[model samples]
Target: MKKTGIAGFLLSVCLLLAGCTSQNVDTTPVWQQTLPQTGVQMEVSNCTLENSGPVYYAMDRVDTDYWTEKTAVQVEGVPVVTLYGVDPEEVELRFVENVSYLYIYYDKVMPQPDLDYVLTETNDGALQYRLDTVYNYEFVITTEQGTDSMMVICHRDSLESANTGTT
Candidate 1:
């Protein structure tokens, strides 16, 4: 009886240790854990226009605030373009083309059913989701030499400032 009890105790301990150690071993590959396409890129021109539109002002404000609070750098001159978006659960932004345009992209993880429903309803065969809930604005500055464009993307809260009616 004594021998049987000792063996059972040892077996239980071995099983417990095995269970604990198994969790520490990672079998997934490094590439599987990270996305290949992630991050932001930007380019902007140095030339400034006498008439900067609302879009330009908003972009500049966002750039200044982002850099000051996040990057800890005092950037000189205003950004012509800004892009904000997600890439596989990571948020990234890029300002590009001599600050001529801002391109934003982001990765979002929504429920598969909800995403499917949204896509089916908004697809319109264009593969672009119809943005019904967001407010968008564009400001263009035409110069003798060329044209400069500014775009503003905001949620409903910011739309009140523009005096656009929302339901």
Candidate 2:
């Protein structure tokens, strides 16, 4: 009985040592060593829901540098552009603009919640201008839930007009 007990104890020790051994080694940095130097091509999608004005665009795995450049132009001279529901440390913002529209991009460190309050409050209401133009633009939140990428669009002009009580 004593010999059997000793054998069991030895087996347990061996199992514990085996468990401690690293099974899969990953030496790569947690964040990519180098993000894409150029802007990533984004796919634009129309909002499916009715009355959700303006087309939407998105790209998964976009590099940090790309987002930075895009947001730089979008937020120029814009006061109080706040990014919420995301870890401030792990993300970067980019502002960009063309003849057509302004674009804001975010390089998120983790999947974060969408800023729904901003969306609901500003959509198709008095606050539309505040979300449309650069004068009062906002960071539209994006998130991954299950297999879908949830996005919110900011209509700067509407938001602005609503705030100032201008028709």
Candidate 3:
């Protein structure tokens, strides 16, 4: 009877300890943190940050497992994220804070210069377009082959201060 009582007491203590030891887990994504400005290639979730000289871009292999990757670059100091893979028909950009100006780039096949517009071409030959004043910026890019989506996170409060700038 004493052994049974001791066993029951031990079991109760173990149960209490187990309940007290439960850990609070964070389900938040890791990319929301302050990313390294060193431009070194690193892994975040299923994506990889790729380095090219002084610039760094995020690449995910979800578009094609074999030889293709969806790539994105945060526009320096400005609160902008440019995603590139193939020719995108539609693209949306989002930030956690209030976004003032959102830009979408639709590449024209010919190098025709329009006198009234400012065009910034990416390294992958994609033309840029500006979408003004969005409160909740959620960006999505759709191509003929597939659709790639990304979230533009501002690591700092001052990141959204300027319409255009690079860190």
Candidate 4:
């Protein structure tokens, strides 16, 4: 009986040690290192959700798969970030978690000094602006409690030059 008890203790210790020895760790960078050369790109948005509705935000550089997480009944107002961009189409803001009722507004002109651009209102109440040259535009989103904003930039000049192979 003593021998059986001793064997059982040994087995339990081995199992505990095995569990301690294995762990899953994710080690990935939080941001893309190289900038896209010739495309409309927006940096990942970092903001908080307020008013219990949809708003613009992003997860950290790591674990940015916002679509994978189950929707929460109530977001805890944590600062999250998401990276999204487009080359030509008007940029769209996506609120990763709770987004049933988010609203966004775009500035009429590009934010850069001495830059002139125009924004046209779309049928869906969103604004659409096409970039003829490399430019950055600033926009804002608001929820019930507060508002957050981000910048969208397009590198169309680079793309045009690349296609022409002149620069």
The number of the candidate with the highest TM-score is: 3
**Candidate 4, which segments miss by more than 4 Å at Cα?**
1-115, 142-144, 159-167
Error of 1 at 23 (Å): 49
Return whichever of 1 and 4 wins on TM-score. 4
TM-score of each: 0.18, 0.21, 0.28, 0.25
Query: Which has the higher TM-score value, candidate number 2 or candidate number 3?
Result: 3
> What C-alpha lDDT do the candidate models reach, one value each?
0.27, 0.28, 0.33, 0.31
Regions of model 1 farther than 4 Å from truth: 1-54, 57-62, 65-117, 120-125, 136-167
Q: Give the alpha carbon lDDT tens digit for every residue of 39-137 in model 4.
A: 322222122222122233334323334423221212111112222332223333422222222222222322332123333343434333322223322
Distance from true position, residue 49, model 3, in Å? 11
Using lDDT as the measure, which candidate wins?
A: 3
Write the residue-wise lDDT of candidate 2 on 1-167 in tens digits. Answer: 99999999999999997885423322222111111222211121111111223333334224323332222111111122222233333232322212123232333332222321211122222111112222222233333321112223323423421212132
| lDDT of each residue in 1-167, candidate 3, tens digit only | 99999999999999998985452323222233222332222212211222212211222223222322223333222222233343333543333221122232222221122321123455765434322222222345554545444433222333431222333
The lDDT, on a scale of 0 to 1, for candidate 3 is: 0.33
Task: Rank the models by lDDT, top first.
Answer: 3, 4, 2, 1
